[model samples]
Target: MFNITQWSLKHWLAAALLVFFALFPLSGDLFYTSLLNRMIVMAIAVASLNLILGYGGMISLGHAAFIGIGAYSVGIPAYYDIYNGWLHLALALIGCGLFAFVTGAISLRTRGVHFIMITMAFSQMAFFAFVSIEEYGGDDGLVVNGRSEFFPFGDIENNVTLYYVSFIVLVAVLYLVYRLVNSRFGGVIQGAKANERRMRAIGHNTYKYQLTCYVISGMMCGLAGALMANFSNFISPDMMGWVRSGELIFMVILGGSGTLFGPLFGTGLYLLLEEFLSRSALYTFVTENIAFLNDAQPWVYWQLPFGILLILVVLYARGGVDGFLSRWGSKNG
Candidate 1:
């Protein structure tokens, strides 16, 4: 029943990757599974960011604020013993949608750097607001009493189950985004992104389209936030901090903007590099062999190599890793 001819190389690769991930837990390592869960959740968030930034040409530095709101929606409710997973998810989506609708309405009026600054300001305001909430652990963050309940399916307490759920969600989000980007509405959004004046001249309400895209992106990120809270069993103001927002943007840019799978690759590569450098064998060797650096904190310097890699990617790989790979494959073919 399946037609292989209908699928592209990228689709095949995606299938293979999914199969690999599905069987990844056979290794019996919960740590790796947990890490992959985080990656999946983050991939969703980064993809949501890409929808607005890469395709819609809207740079929202406060995007993580929506994520935080989603997270806290779960955390705050759970703190009061409201353990319904579906309810938490609904609250997250609604809360994030309303916030994005209000903020996007205002932010869409600005362009370029002003949009970025306003988003950042909103995010900071959210971070501080969460910090000032005394009952929810304040600056220390809130620990979830238990994982979300899925009723008949039950809680996602098992690492493997959580990983699979997150993976399925990621796949769904990717497919949704792919469909959206290829749709007539998506064309209008992209056209507006390319040239708002032309789109406006053609009778397209650029503001409405952009705000709709923004709300959609925010809701997607909010879903990711719910998963994040479930993944860590903790929620904090730090989840929505400016630094996290910046990291999400970096993942989008590093993975190749406007490409559906780029964010996944970017998030995986960035997180993996961060993990590797933090406990790198090179760091160990340097600390052991170099006398002067023996007492130094090698982990502090882990970002140096990542920074260099980023610079190289930006300078040489114009379209990020995904674009570079596509070009390389085409050239070789």
Candidate 2:
């Protein structure tokens, strides 16, 4: 639990946001409710990446593979009528942990570009492996007939129930990451990131610490993937595609990789930008009003602006969105 005594501007704002989300379903807007669910799930996934990229100092281009594994963990079972929530979650955790362990063991042996490529290579291997299996619809993917069931406790019958469940998971994941990053294990990780030679000389066994961190991050992302599978009721290889992995990286960097609330805020802003450029009235305004350039579809070029903005952040912002917020958010604190 977070101490109120340490609450700053962003913390209070996050609390307010959570309160609003808690009460939001009462309004009964199904579209936005579902949208918020995606934001929460994406935030969870990105937060897992933060643990590796921000604190663990490892850059991975294949993190989405865990999410895919997690999704398939749910989807494959549902195909055969196994909807027990515990079973689904357990598979997600175990499958991702195993995958992470194998990949991290090999990837950690290298550093720089070699490390990034190996991790991605392993993720692509998983992607193709799933794609080759015809039992689960091959590249077409699998469908979940029903949401995961928890039996005596409850089941995700409605989007609202899933919404709250996902939100709670997000909070739990954040707490877990917060604790891990502040612990001695986290110290070793960041230390290795700073000076691997020094950490190794001090008897840290940096490789072991990093592999553990890698596995932890993968398991967390797997949880998000399970929730995502339940939410969308579908799973495809594209869910673990390299493009999606890149998006996860974008969100982490955009949100500030090492900061606690960065992923949450970053995912929110990313989705908001998607909404504005792709489905919002702003697109309508551009398509409907502009005189000589009416043929121009500004939404199609959405990434142009986003790419420019990201470049600015990379060049200018120290800690991404979190750093920018801290400047103005902690005046009184």
Candidate 3:
């Protein structure tokens, strides 16, 4: 009943990407592979944001607060000797969900720009709360004792194994998001996004739908944060900072917000640029004659490239990289 030829191009492309990632360990050095891990984790977070912004039409500037909640969920528990691996992750998701529920309830009361402002306010509140918690390294941040281990085998600290773990989780979360967006509930959310008045006219509770999507997005972002903390063995208030939130938004916008694979591409692009800049500075000494060029801090001027790229994307590629590719494909086909 199932024919490979009948599969959509997007499905085929997703399959190809998955296969490529599966074999990536064999094709690249550990450093590159680790960078891939970070990209994939951040992509998961960005995709969660896309669910809210692209699907629900809720523009949240403070989404990083949920991520911070997730990271601290694991980090703080480990510090207190209350670590139970998956249980910690569950708690983080629950915490983010509750936070989103409460915040969305309040913020959704105000529409458009006001909603964004209220969300920003709550996110700042979360940032300050983490800063005030003198224990668990407070402002400095807490280093994870080690990567969490899966039960029975209990050796998940291995880098390669962690890569596979993260990959699997990324795949699973993406699939879950796809299903959520296609379901009946997802239709309501999307409807609300397209036209809140119409959704209300159809007897649907638009506010409830928006709030639900917001909570779901927050929970997913929180999950990514928990994994990120475990991956890096560190957690800090910086995770919840406004700039970090902006970066996440940048990832979504760069990748093509509505496309499932766009966030992955965006995160990959951003991290690759970051890794390149960081490594370029390390290699600067090799060109001793460069003089002043070598003297400058690579990161100090990194924002120029990103800012320029953002301007280009906004002016030309409104739908982002994935959208650009889609347009190209349609023309060629």
Candidate 4:
């Protein structure tokens, strides 16, 4: 849909990454492919949060609850011997939209830290609610018996098939969000973020715009959750934990909160950094070599470096990774 001449560096990078991933499965490296698959799923979740947080300025910390809902839609259904892919997806979307509608209506009434705290409280409510359900494994978690099946030819049990499906979903989400942020509804949401009182003064129902945006965001995140459950073959209260929400927030901000494709970059960066820190032999060697770190577990201190990087980004780069890339062109990705 985009013209080549108008494309920026970030645009080119996005295209290149897509090409890479499309061909990555052909290499037959299951480990990295699965890792990238997980990245694809998290990227979708991050993008959903970006819709409300970046454009609508909702700053919700409860988005992970929606993800949990989507996962449970799949897990619970599978528990009852229902393995229909379309049904799971339908449930995920419906559940997330309903929860977002009810919660968003109430949460939107507040502002600033109150909004964040209230959302977090709601997320914890969902987390514990699931934890209390022993029949579904509760705190231990629920297992997905099999991958979803959409058609006779559509089998998600194969990693390659799932990767392509996730990739297509990622592309569709990007295009949909791009169209949304540039549309009339997007303008109203952004306008509300800028000045709600003025938007209301001009006859716009700011609350409606924000709540609708929130619901749409939740639905999209629920889709990601469905994919995630398929990928991990498991679901738990931990998926809805506030910490996961915080991590999603970190990804959005790190990649450029308000811009297109920011979530992809942010999530990719966050996961890659975590992967490195979590399994880096270099860290082990350095820690063992350095006397001061000899007694310290190398993996235990990954956050120190990560925290410092985040601080640096916050201090020096307001637009995040995508924003930094935007500097190369007049267009924002």
Candidate 5:
């Protein structure tokens, strides 16, 4: 049996990724650095989703709602002149965790489609709440005046400083997830996924375990949301919408669920493809080489290609990119 207790210390892909991220900002392009930051942020969120979906066997469509909660966690406090970063992050995380725990407790009473629907409903409730925060900017959203200033550490508004902070958090979260997935609690959660009925019959309170995992996932995503709000220096209701939730799901699916590093790869590829296609289309339209696309915006049409790619991956690659890569490597070896 492969020892679950022992993990390869020299994880080549992860190590390579760490080196790449460290060097990316040295290129000094604001756009590239900013995009990298966004990718890392979304990657963290997607990893949070995988904890429940891949490990705990919970299908939550409203995962991004926690991120919305987190963003507003800091955004609202900042609006009220609470500029302490650590305090704001702590409050947001605690609030999101408590909210998720309450919601998950109720939602875990149901299973399968019912659980999914209930979670979706809860997320919608959050979406409406943000929209109703008229004191903050309502539908139009609020432009952030500046990011939280960490006393003595200097301004977090600087891109390089923010990037490093985000990178450290991402690494820290990933390590925490690694520990969680290998712990005693993780065994029960994975068993629950494989056979909840058997786990329950064995005297495990599966509902509690599931609820705990759900709340942890939410709190982690909330952290990502807080970082995102700071990075973008803005907050809006749209961040909590169904579309944002769908995007999180897509990131998980695209990256190959069940793997620790898959989400990072998935988010990177997804964002890069979007950027490249959009830029190419803009250049083509300006040059008028592609006659049919001259007046049409490329981004609106890029979804068609993305949709096709999703269909292909679903039909041909059941295990996602990680699975596909493993198979290829084995065959080549």
Candidate 6:
């Protein structure tokens, strides 16, 4: 039995968020619900990346490749008419873990810009591999005709049901990460991140620790990928693109890399801004008010504002939104 007496404000806030998410579906707006579902999935993916980039001090620009692997794990099996949810998820976790093990073995040997370039190269290789799979729609992508079967629970076709499932997984992952970061192994990895030379001098096998962390992160992201495939009911090579990897990195940084809930905040904020900018009335206003802009799509420039926001976050909130909030809280307290 877990004791509730030791729970702090952070724990309470997490509970409140879960409660809010649980009830959000009652609003009955399918569009918003769908957006929230994507946000939850992206939150998991970004958090997994944060595990390596923030805690382990490993920079991987190919993280999305593992996600793409996971997506294909589901898509490929389902292409053969296999639709078991458990099986798809297991395949995703195992496949991504193996891929991470191999890639991490090679990539972890390098550091700095070389490491970044190597990861990006691996990701590009993965992207090309997926594109070469002509039977699976190749560059066009594959559509899942039906949702994965969960036996007693059935398939997750219901938007509300899917939302709850995603929310539960997100909460579980957050808790798992929180516990992992406080464990002895986590301490060793964090120490290695701070100074690998010192860790090695003290008898720690820094490479092994980092590799283990990388694999764990990959598996976690793989799970997110499985969820994403189900959520979108599609898988494409684009999922493995370097652009997606960059977005994941940005989400982790924007949310405050080292914080447990930072990735969630960052994912939600980034996606929300993207959605708003792409669909907002401001785009219509710009096209209507400016004659020269009428011929071009105004929404295409949504990145302009998003890029500006990113710059502002980097300049002022170096620790990300989470860090800024923490500072504000401490100051007021």
* Candidate 3 Cα outliers beyond 4 Å, as residue runs: 1-13, 153-155, 277-296
Winning candidate number (lDDT): 4
lDDT of 3 at 235: 93
The CA-based lDDT of model 1 is what? 0.88
Candidate 5 regions exceeding 4 Å error are: 1-11, 281-297
Candidate 6 lDDT over 283-329, as tens digits, reads 66776788887788666677877899899998999888778777775
Write down the lDDT of every candidate, Cα atoms only: 0.88, 0.89, 0.82, 0.91, 0.82, 0.87
lDDT of 2 by residue, 1-333 (tens): 368887777777677877877788899999999989999999999999999998878999999999999999999999999899999999999999999999999999999899889888988999999999999988999988999999788899789999999999999999999898899999998999889999989888899999999999999999999999999988999899888999999899888888898998789888888776665565566557768447775656556666777788878977878877777686655
Clashes of each: 0, 0, 0, 0, 0, 0
Candidates in order, TM-scores: namely: 0.94, 0.93, 0.91, 0.94, 0.92, 0.94
Worst 10 residues of 6 by lDDT: 6-15
Candidate 3 Cα lDDT to native: 0.82
Instruction: Write one digit per residue (lDDT tens) for candidate 1, span 148-265.
Output: 8889889887777888888898988988899999998899889998999999899998899889999999999999999999899988999999999999999999888888878887
Off by over 4 Å in 4: 286-299, 328-333
In candidate 4, the residue pairs with backbone N, CA or C atoms under 3 Å apart (3 or more residues apart, or in different chains) clash, namely: none
Better of 2 and 3 by TM-score: 2
Model 6 alpha-carbon miss at residue 329, Å: 0.3
Q: Which has the better TM-score: candidate 3, or candidate 5?
A: 5
Would you list the clashing residue pairs of candidate 2?
Answer: none
Clashing pairs in 1: none
Error of 6 at 60 (Å): 0.8
lDDT of 5: 0.82
Each prediction's RMSD over C-alphas, in Å, is 2.0, 2.3, 2.8, 2.2, 3.0, 2.1
Q: Report lDDT (Cα) of residue 322, candidate 1.
A: 78
TM-score of 5: 0.92
* lDDT (tens digit, per residue) of candidate 5 on 153-205: 87688898889888888888888888999999998989999999899899998
